[model samples]
Target chain A: MKLYDYILSGNCYKIRLFLSFLDINYETVPVDYYPGREHRFPDFLEINPLGQLPVLVDDEVKLRDAQAILIYLASKYDTSGRWYPRNPEAMGKIAMWLSFAGTEIMNSSNARLHDMLAYDLDADKARANAHAAFRILDDHLVEVGFAGQEWIAGTQPSIADVACFPYVALSRDGGIEHDDYPAIQSWLTRIQSLPRFIDMPGIHFMK
Target chain B: MSINFNKYHWFAFYASQQIMPAEIRARSMWNTDIAVWREENGSIHAWKNRCPHRGMRLSYGFIRGSQLVCLYHGWNYEGATAQCSYIPAQPNLKGPKTACVRDFACFEKHGLVWISTVAEAEKEPDFSDFGEAEQTIHFCRSIFVNESPGLVGEILKTSIFIPYGNDLADGAKLKIETSQAEHHQTGANYQAIWQSGRDKKKKTELTCQTEVRNNAILVNHYKDDQGNEGSLIFALLPIDDKKTGVHVLFSGDFSSQSLTSAKRHYAKWAKRMRWSIENRNLQTDSFNPWI
Candidate 1:
């Protein structure tokens, strides 16, 4: 599998983390996204006309969108039921949450982070959206305690936790403080303590 | 040669969407013009959708015991393969293929009946994805002429599938039964038939144009000029739907505090897919017809 990225993308980092956890072997194809670079080239369009990050290529299969790749890997390789699990009820529980990450967090939170990193920080709107998202989590953590006793989906650390971890884990870099939600904070600590956990790949890995 | 994918190529097709249910093609099981019927025993038999002697669609035909008698001709067809069992003048010729109309290929799964698009067929269609925990909804099928299945997989953001099963276990369950674990056999309960064909005038198969609106992508699976099938179905895993949280430990939304200028490209891909489908070859790498 070939992973295309700019190195610092937290979205890309998510792929790397899962790959490391499963120990699935793959090759990384780094795409240059600087002014008028790899994205606009004819070759890239042939690969993914949509032109997005973290494209996982396995022979004839090319996965461009992050969320799709996350599902593909988890569904394809996980036999342990520890990562991507099976069972109808557990399946529904996981599906609804993953959808939330796409429809909500990525659009509201990650979009703001991407904008801020681009240098035009809409601090006020970003801050408001951040708080709005936080409130939802605050209530949720209260509904279901945040202790490491059980991972996001009740028992195991699943793609649900993987899907939500990165952006929120690095929210501080984008100027959103993490002090407000103690439950969320403790949950973060628990995730960090996992056995095969790896650090978020930083900007320098691009070269 | 123009590939019609209709009666000429595929006689029938079936898809067992991982997150969805198995589907059947009941439209083409006609004998001349009469439709087929099954007895209470779950046996499937076909006939002309219409009676040859008069012309009433067999869909309107009545089933008594194991026989399907056309309401118009009062003609009786064989209960098993739907051969004409009785014709006022042809009683002696009884239930033979010569006295029959059309008998299409019918296959079954789970608890449903499936007709084929072709005569000579081999290999069960790939459906390993149904066992995967991922979300796969076979809503409206749109075929881009000659587009590869893997390419189709890449286009999907939240839902997709690869043609090869190399990425997944051949069977649904993975068990360690012996030292040679590779030889251990496992299983997944897959059903091809389930007595669930909804009756409607609009052809069940359709096609439509998809677009990117606001920031969300909308795929409209409405009908087109040619007769086809289309509809929108979303298959995704569960996650928190709430958009806001009260604090850090409580949420995971990213915030940008840095003054450094960051450029984020806003992209929403939208395109209209045509819905002229002929043979839905379960074994196809290209969902489109092959000329």
Candidate 2:
């Protein structure tokens, strides 16, 4: 497996974190997503036409989108069937949250890109949308917590949790503080506590 | 009901469990930004959010054992004294005495963490009304309101709490009447009477009593129709004039089986109260419910 990754990109870090959790050894093709802007180059564009930082190539399988890659990796590698469960209800819930992570939660990622990488985007709107998404997630977590469940989808950790972890953890870089989302903060701590969990530039190991 | 909103009173801000070890919670209370963290030994500390070395938010830092390490530079501050203990750059030298983070009075009580801006506070809020000595206090949730604490407190006085148990039916109209005509802005104290819908076949009435220990704690005692009693405690933390945090905790004889659903029920009530209070003005008959 070869992953086109950027150290600072939360989207790319999502893939890297899952790979580490699975304890899979893979090669990395580092992309200069920052000042170099190599992701926009012709060759990099050929790899992923979306100009995204993370493009995973696993043997003959090529995947884009962090959530989809998470699904593929979990289906292929996670023999334990805990990360991406085969249960119908569990898969449906996890897929719902995966979509949420890719769409609504990405606002935090956009805001971070605007602030950290000086991307030309409306950061205020992104932050506002990110807060709205965080509110929904925090409320859901609190509700589920009342039922004694820890992970986002089921009783166990799933790719949905991994899919949603990075941007929310890195929201501070975008000035979207987690102070208001106590449940989300607790969930982030749980994710950080997971076995073989790793951290990127903004998100650090709690230890 | 005269109470001081400025200082000397312990205000509950976050739920106790939210301040986990090895993590920092940044909060603002009484115009001061506080960085609250707990040591691995389970002792908690709240200090000025700014690091004396470079004004970096100490909350942005990480905790290593008994020390909070600044992110900008590896300046470690002792959790006990908030004093700069070590600097990686100056490994051979002891940190200067001036490099200390200002500490605040912080403690946990009644399932919530309370902080006092002043080093010495009057006393912790009294939770005897809820029988804290015997009953287990369950933290429902904390809601951040983009309004004044006074406003939130006023609204809470009239805020209806549906019984967590199967005591009250849906669409039951509840009206609140307070004994006092006017409540002081600093703190509140009043007795309330909650009357259920007159339309019900058997009208249920609850005499609600509120006790304010200090400027922040509001204990609402309720007796349901079935003679079961419960207490809803609201600890208001005035983050500033505009921003306020309301931490809700409930105490009752909840069986182990029913506790989880009870918590979920009250959490929904708290979130609804926040939404209504925040959007009361924009609410109209024509208001889009889906929006």
Candidate 3:
């Protein structure tokens, strides 16, 4: 298995973190996503048409999106069957959050891009959208806390948490603060406390 | 109303549980950056967020045993004295005494962590009204609101809370009454006399009182008709000119099942209260989201 990865990219870190958690031996094809912008080059675009940071190539299966890569990795490698459960209800909820992580939560990524990489994007709008998404996630976590559950989709840690964890944890890079979202803060701590957990550039190691 | 927290007074900015052991959290108040962390031995410390070495945010550092190791260059600061304990580059040389993060007076009480801006504090904020020794304390949540502490206090003066554990009816409006001040130096006391007056013909009065002690602590006591009572302590922390954080703790004799339910109920209420305050729907008077 070869994963095209970027050190600073949270999406790519999600794949790297999950691979470490699953104890899967995968070769990392480093991509100069920062100052070099190699992902946008023709050679990298051949690997992923969308020119994204993380493109997982495992034997014959090729995945483009980070969320899709997470689903694929968990379905194939997670022998414990707890990361991506087979239950229908759990799958539905996890899929919904995965969709949210790719769409709404990506606003935080865009904001970070604007701030850290000096990308020409609407940082204010991205921060506002990120705050809106954090509000929803925080409220959902509070509701789940009422049921005595910690993980996002279910009781156990799922790919949904991995998909959404990075951008929210790295929101401060885009000037987004977590002071208002106490529930989300607690959830981040719990995610960091998981076994085989790893940290990237912006996300601090809690334990 | 502007609150000058630069003086020597203990203000509770966060719940005790929020500061996990062996974890570093960045907290700010009155434009002063603070790094509040807990040791593995359960001892809590608050110091200036900046590292004396390179002005790096000490909050961004990690904890090793009782020391906060700076992320920039690995300068270890001791827990109790905030003195420089170790330097990774020069292993044998002792760090200078002046190379220390400025410390503050910190204490944990009533399920909340209190911090004093000055190093020497004559006394901690006395929350004698709650009598926490007699009741079980449950931290509800710490809510960050986009408003001044003074305005938040004013809103609390006339704010109406939802019923706790199906105690009051759904649409019953709880009216608030502002009583005379007990004393100014310590804090003002407002008797939040609420009347469930939705149905004017069948008016039911549910008594609840709020006490503002030490200009930071707001003690709210709610009693149901069936004698099921709970008190919520709102410890407000003024972050800056436009932001305030309210740490809430519930003290009552509740069963395990009822405790969780009551915490959920109050947590939702606190969230809605923040929404109301942020949206300008709540004010000193004429603010009733329940209606």
DockQ of each: 0.01, 0.77, 0.50
DockQ value of candidate 1: 0.01
In DockQ, how does model 3 score against the reference complex? 0.50
TM-score for each predicted model, relative to the true structure: 0.39, 0.90, 0.88
Best by lDDT: 2
Residue lDDT tens for model 1, A1-207 = 788875666778878878887888887778886544686788888877877676888777878777788889988887776777778876776776677555555534454455545635566676667655654554354334412234566677888777777766666556564433444554565576676677863211110
Model 2 docking grade:
medium
- Name the 10 consecutive residues with the lowest summed lDDT in model 3 chain A: A198-207
Q: What C-alpha RMSD separates each model from the true structure? A: 29.2, 3.7, 3.7
TM-score of candidate 1 versus the correct structure, residues matched by position: 0.39
- Candidate number with the higher DockQ (1 or 2): 2
Error of 3 at A17 (Å): 1.3
Error of 1 at B241 (Å): 30
Ranked by TM-score from best down, the candidates are 2, 3, 1
Best by TM-score: 2
